[model samples]
Target: MNFEYMKNFMDSLTEWIIPGNSVVIYKDGKKVFEYSSGYSDLEKKIKKTGEEQLYIYSCSKVATVTAALQLYEQGKFLLSDPLYEYLPEFKKMYVKDGDRIKAAENPITIRDLFTMTAGLSYATNTPAFEKARKLTDGKMDTRTVIKCLAEEPLLFEPGARWNYSLCHDVLAVLAEVVSGMRFSEYMKKNIFEPLDMNNSYYHTPNDVIISPQYIYEIQDTKNIVELQQKEHTTGVVKRAYGNELVFGENYDSGGAGIITTVDDYAKFAAALANSGTGLNNNRILSSATVKLMKTNQLNEAQRKTMNWRRLRGYGYGLGVRTLIDKAESGSNSSIGEIGWGGAAGATIIADTEEKVALFYAHHMLNPQEEYYQPRLRNVLYSCL
Candidate 1:
């Protein structure tokens, strides 16, 4: 692959984008390109390395889903199984209408959570979610927060519509209950260890120094500001060495918690791209299971319900976004490319058809990542 243009782009990140960034691309289970630029801590003058860990945010969802599927492969639960079976708090949930609350027509199923159709919204301005947040205002336990989420009314009836939400957070608790292990423990044993992803974790290690996070501000058009520490009520907390909420004693968030480095994440991405086999020749997931994960699982209505602009030509899969139409997506990626991104400009795309896996990590909190992500895809796929 021609990496001249890619190298130029990486070099420009510190000047044009964020202070530090890393990119890694793998093809056929081998590293084809890898690059890092700028400092992990600009104030401290620490250069970024392949081992510098950063919070992956929502990208952690795919790992949680992969762990859940391992249990599914073992016949522990079915996609159609009602969530109430695992967490009885969801036995009789309700939905909040304009001014009234009504009983949900059906119970939320495991598949509904995977497809974002469970009507569970994130902590938002809505009355229901606001109340949900209050339940765990100063707490860190995953089961406690999830049960509180269940007590809150849904935004819509289960399976009636799709909404990006805290459904995966609940899935984390379900995985723990089903696997008879902690969420992080299950991931380490079944996913990270097998793939040799030594730098991935639900919590930042106590001894390792991590890259500092930043936020691009419109007020300072030419400079990025270091993100200050703040209390977060959404069950996730932003910290210097990655996020702190997932580090709670009993909380292992599935939606947005895992921290990893470029090479470590590439290992996970390569396994997905290579039919669930890691570079070490260990099977992290069955090939059939990976195929199912990459397949579009949403129906027409659910597809229509997606609110994110970047999901225009994509469809919801188990955990990642599956490219259903290359032309409509306005990119050169082949159909069936599956991946997800974090809020802090971290993204991973695994194209099974091209046998390519691409990962980009930057510690800048930029909502405009939609622009850069596809740009990266277009550049990489064009070279191919």
Candidate 2:
């Protein structure tokens, strides 16, 4: 494969857009190509070693879905089963009307959480979270916080459409409840342990130093400029969020909370690409289950809500976006190619059809994904 063009594109990105980026690609469960471009500490001139811990934000959902599916494979729950079956607090949900809220017409199903059709919103500053904070004494544990979320009104009836919300976080609680383990504990024993992903974590270990995170603003109409950490008001220095999505010590944000390195997380991506088996020959899921993981779960009406520009030719899968239309996307990716990106430039590409996996990230927040994601996928396919 000719990876020269892809490498050059990455180098160009480090020069102008974000400070630095790293990528690890695998084919058939073996590392094929790896590169780290630019610097990790731009101020200190420290290069990206491909070992620095990065907060993968929404990319955590990929792992979350994989974890929950293990339970599915074990016959712990069915996709169509009501979420209330596992977490009884959801038995009586409410939906928001114009200025009033009323009980929801339909119950939320496990399928709704996987497909992001649960009608939940990304809003976190509601009274529900506040109540949860008080109840947990600021710990904001998974079960208590998620249960409090049920008191908040949903945007619509469950399963009516797709909405990117805290559904995966609730799925984390599902894993915790059914497996009788904390979300973090369940992931470590099931995912990290099996795949040999030693560096990934739900909390930043005090010993490991994380990469410096940054946020940028538009300098001119077309140029982007970096803001010093002290000058920035939005970014949380070196992490994805402080308490926005990841609540506290006890909370495990399956939706947007994962701290990992490119080299480590790529192993998980490679497992998906290699049909649920790791490079070390550990099988994380059955091949059939991996296929279901990437299959498009959205219908025509539900797809209308996934209007992100970067997802032009894709459909929402269990958690990731699966390629559905090549001509519409102008992409060279395989038909069932699936993956997702983070708010801070982390990207995952899992093409089980071709046995190819790629994980990439730039240590910057508010990653302009629209410009790079589709192009990067298209370029990777061209290299192959």
Candidate 3:
């Protein structure tokens, strides 16, 4: 394995991605690679340690979905179960055709949300979604947001297409209602503590000051300008008020929110890669459930509908995306590799067939500059 390329890739990341941080890679249940560079607090000139937690963004979706699957395994819910059963507000949802809000002939199911085919989009260019945003207005709080979503019409019929929307937010609330506990509490009890992911949480306390997020913005001609050295004030940040924001507020958003460190998250990913075995030989999930979760649930046309890079022939599983074609992925990813990333640039990739897992976390949201997902994946696979 030519690790020189990986080292180069990690070094180059400082120029393109997070200024300084740490990365950890595991193979066959061992830490095969680790690197730390730059500083966690650039202003204070504090070098980044191996233990600082990073905002694991949408990567939290995997944890929330895993909790949902646990409930499913306990016969609390089913894939085919109409989602509206647990969240009745989702019932009577309709679609916007021209000027009218026509009722959807079918109800959106839990499977629809998992498969990204529920016709429920998030911050996308759909008439209904646009209207939904306006309806919710500044009240993006947990209860008001979902109420707005329930009132809005679906963009397409259930199972008609795939779009990355706020489906996970809805999932978070669903987990709460069905499990009879708040979403955060449910995760802490079932997923976090069980897996010893003690460093993971949704919010950062005021006293726990770290360097606020910073990024480069392209200015005139070729000059790149430094954006505001401020914390990201979207989604969870806005709701980080009241009731000690160290834990997430009421915005039970399953898609994003989990905060974790390189070590704790690596253990979680290793468990998924190791057929659900965690610390002390405790199995967080059965091998059967994990296998089922990795299976592709999209068909040919559905696969064609997904337009994102690295997702050409991918399908959504219970939580992770399932790869159906390596050639289409245009990377060295295995046929059965499953994983996803967070909005803040945190990423986790697991190749169950190959028994490998990769975890990287940084805080950059420029989706255009091309992060190290495929590059690192190819490098890791080439090592094998």
Model 2 misplaced stretches (Cα beyond 4 Å): 219-243
In model 2, pairs of residues that clash are none
lDDT tens readout by residue for model 2, 1-384: 878878998987776556788999998777888898888987777997788898899999999999999999999999999999999999999998989998899999999999999999899889999999899999989899999998888999998988889999999999999999988999999999999999999978889877888765434333223332223233323444443568888889999889999999999999999889998899989999988988899989999989988898899888889999999888899999999998789999999889999999987776778778988998888888
Among these predicted structures, which one has the highest lDDT?
2
Measured against the true structure, the TM-scores of the candidates, in listed sequence, are 0.89, 0.94, 0.84
Name the weakest run of 10 consecutive residues (lDDT summed) in model 2.
Answer: 223-232
RMSD of each: 5.3, 3.3, 5.6
The per-candidate count of clashes, in order, stands at 0, 0, 1
Off by over 4 Å in 1: 124-139, 219-247
Candidate-wise lDDT, in order: 0.80, 0.87, 0.69
Model 1 steric clash total: 0
Query: What does candidate 1's lDDT look like per residue over 177-244, in tens digits?
Result: 99899888889999999998888887666887667776654432322231222121111223344464
Model 1 — TM-score against the truth? 0.89
lDDT of 3 by residue, 301-342 (tens): 766687776566567777688777777777777787888876
How well does candidate 3 score on lDDT at residue 326?
Answer: 73
Q: Residue 370 lDDT in model 3? A: 39
